[model samples]
Target: MNETELASYWNNNAPAWIELSRAGYDIYRDYLNTPAFFTILPDVKGLKGIDIGCGEGHNTRLLATKGAIVDAIDISSLFIESAIKMEKEYPLGIRYTVASATKLPFNNDSFDFATSFMCLMDLPDQEQAVSEAYRVLKPGGFFQFSIEHPCFKTPYQRKVENAQGDIAFEVGNYFKSANGTIEEWIFGDAPDELKNRLPKFRIPNFHRTLSWWINTLISVGFSIELLHEPYPDEEAVLNKPKLKAAREISYFLQVRCRK
Candidate 1:
């Protein structure tokens, strides 16, 4: 899909995004609370930070609470509206804007730090977004990002099957590069009985090798500082058996870089 189409797609699903987040908050809590995510910036007490693709401004609020001057931006007007509502309900003093990641409405070296969570892969022009991130961040400023692991979460992989009436996951190709047309699923809040009744919506998400991400960061003049593949906490593992197995293998990758 083109840029306009991609924006519209996410805008249409904004309500679903909010519902899914509320329903599966714990599934994401660990990753969001990981040391790699929140502990990296020791001097953010008074620094300027920007959260690109800041859906609903959750992480943006976190940064503000840490004493950073936070600016949040997203392409979806619906998301920006939700974020503004959140700001009004629980003021974080964060600035919100409806803008594209590839063309940030900020000046050079405008922020001391920038972050994008689970957003880069979904963008149509990732390279341009990377460049924009680099442009807005001050020298020595950090730009951290998190995304679905290309290796394990790509379209060719991720499957479910019924084996002798018992539901089991059927793994698919992992090493293969993401090419040609593919269907990307977006999960939402739905009871198990109603899951199948819900439509399978598709989005265009590009999968890139880890090396590709490293090179892209370098090309944008950012040096990679840390890379993490987070595992579920022990409590979560014990409570969710299937997820325990998946966590043993891992699913998402988070990276921190400096401009």
Candidate 2:
């Protein structure tokens, strides 16, 4: 899909996403992605940063609370609108815009740093987004991003149960790159019945290999500073019970690079 088509896809799903995250993080983000990303997040006190694909501005607010002057943008106008409404109710000094991740509307070297939280993989043209991220940061600035681990987040998955009923996850299509929409998305905090009744949240996502991601960053003249493939901590496993597969295998990968 082209940019407008892609934007429409997310725009259509924004309300449901807002509902899912109205109170706080739904379980998937709260447990899986958030921990991994924040573990590698740099101190941004008194800094200027831009969050690409800042969906509904949750993480943008978090950055503001951490003392970063944040300019956040998203492709979906609905998401941007929701974020604006949120800012009015509880101000955190974040400026939200409706913009594409591949093409930010900021001037060159406009920010001290750049960030993308699990957004690059969803973008149809990830290279352009990385290039734009490189363009917006001042020399020596960093771009930190998180993604669904390409090597581990499989398109086809199955659970294998042992004789004692212990379960393990098996996966397929790890190397095949594809784009398609899931029939629906299930938030961790939502009741299964409620999820079934809602329209399927549709968006296109591209899957690429780990090599492709690292090579793209280097090709865009960014030096890798840190990389992390985060798994659930023990306490999370004990509390959540069903997330043991996440503990054994990585679900999210973080990459921080400097221009």
Candidate 3:
């Protein structure tokens, strides 16, 4: 799907998906419990922050609770509305706006910190987003983000159990170029009858190597401060046997960079 189609799809579906499943809240909670999240964002008190691609404003609320003046933006109007409603109840003083990540509406040097969670890969014009991040952040401000681990988490792979009942995962083309194609599944809480009603959309998602990400940050006038490959916690391992096994092999990368 094109950018407009993608935006429309998310705008139409995000409210129900987030409210019904509380996926956004759960994700934010998981981030809070992870070592990578705390380590990447130490001492955020009283800072001016912006969360680009802030879906339901979970991270923005978290930042505000930590004393940051947060402005959260998303392309989806439905998402912004839901976030705004939540903000009213929570009263974190978070400002919600409907804006594109690639074309942020903020002025240059307007923020002391910026964050994007699980959003960079989904963007069709990630270069523009990176540039806008660099433009908005003040010199020496931090721009941190987390994305799916490109090396081992391709969409084609699925978990399986061996004869001994040990969980195992099978993945292909670890060294595939960033432009490699893979099928993605968009599963949520839609009813079985409505499942087929929703279209399966296909779009390009670039998978950059670790070095490529570092170089891109450097080219955008930013320097990498931390890079983490976070593993699932012990409890998650016990409950999610397959994910637990995947954690042993390292499955996610979190990056912190300074502009």
Candidate 4:
């Protein structure tokens, strides 16, 4: 699908997404990913930053709370609209915009930092997005981002007991460049009547190899700073036994690159 179609798909899912995120029901972002991301994120106090693909703006709010002046952008108009309304309630100095990640609307060297949390792989034009991220950052600026681990998050991935009876993540089609895999986000807090009436919360994702990501950023003049494969922390696994799978096999990779 084209960029416009992809943006519309996110627009359609925005309402449910905003509700889920605000309620703190988004397990991945709320419970796991955000904490993991902050562990590696550098101090951003007083830094000018842009959060590419900011979605409903939970992370953007977090950035503002951490003292970064943020301009958060997403391709979906509905998502940006919801985020703007949220800004009124909290009154953080965050500017929300509806714009494509691949073609960021910003001046060169305008930001001290750039970020994309679990967003890069979902874009059709990841190369362009990475380039734009590189372009918008000032010299010595850092871009920090995360994505589903390329080695583990395959097109049709699974987990099973190995010969050793230990849980093994079975990966598939890691080398293929592909897209349109459905990512479902169920809003458990929704009313029963609304559940039946509303459509499934589905979004498309693109998959690429680990090397592709590193090379793309390098080609765009980013020097790799940190590579993190974040697993469930001890507290997380203690709270949720199923999180052991993540401890054994990393579900996401966070990286910091300097431009």
Task: Identify the candidate with maximal lDDT.
Answer: 4
- Ranked by TM-score, the better of candidates 3 and 4 is 4
Candidate 3 residues 18-63, lDDT tens each?
Answer: 6543643243235322346666686889899999888887667777
lDDT of 4: 0.86
| lDDT leaderboard ranking | 4, 2, 1, 3
How high is the lDDT of residue 1 in model 4?
A: 67
Task: For model 2, name the residue pairs that clash.
Answer: none
Each prediction's whole-model lDDT (CA): 0.75, 0.84, 0.72, 0.86
- Candidate 1 ranges beyond 4 A from true positions: 24-26, 29-36, 39-43, 159-190, 193-201, 239-242
- Residue 6 error, candidate 3, Å: 2.3
Best by TM-score: 2
Where model 3 places Cα greater than 4 Å from the true spot, the runs are 23-35, 174-204, 239-242
lDDT of 1 by residue, 55-92 (tens): 87777888898899999999889989999998999998
lDDT of 4 by residue, 13-113 (tens): 88777765676556666667788898789999999999999998889899999999999999999988988998998799999999999888899999999
- What shift in Å separates residue 231 of candidate 2 from its native position after superposition? 1.6
Q: Following a full C-alpha superposition, what root-mean-square deviation does model 1 have from the true structure?
A: 3.4
Q: Candidate 3 — which pairs collide?
A: none
The list of candidate 4 runs beyond 4 A from truth reads: 161-166, 185-198
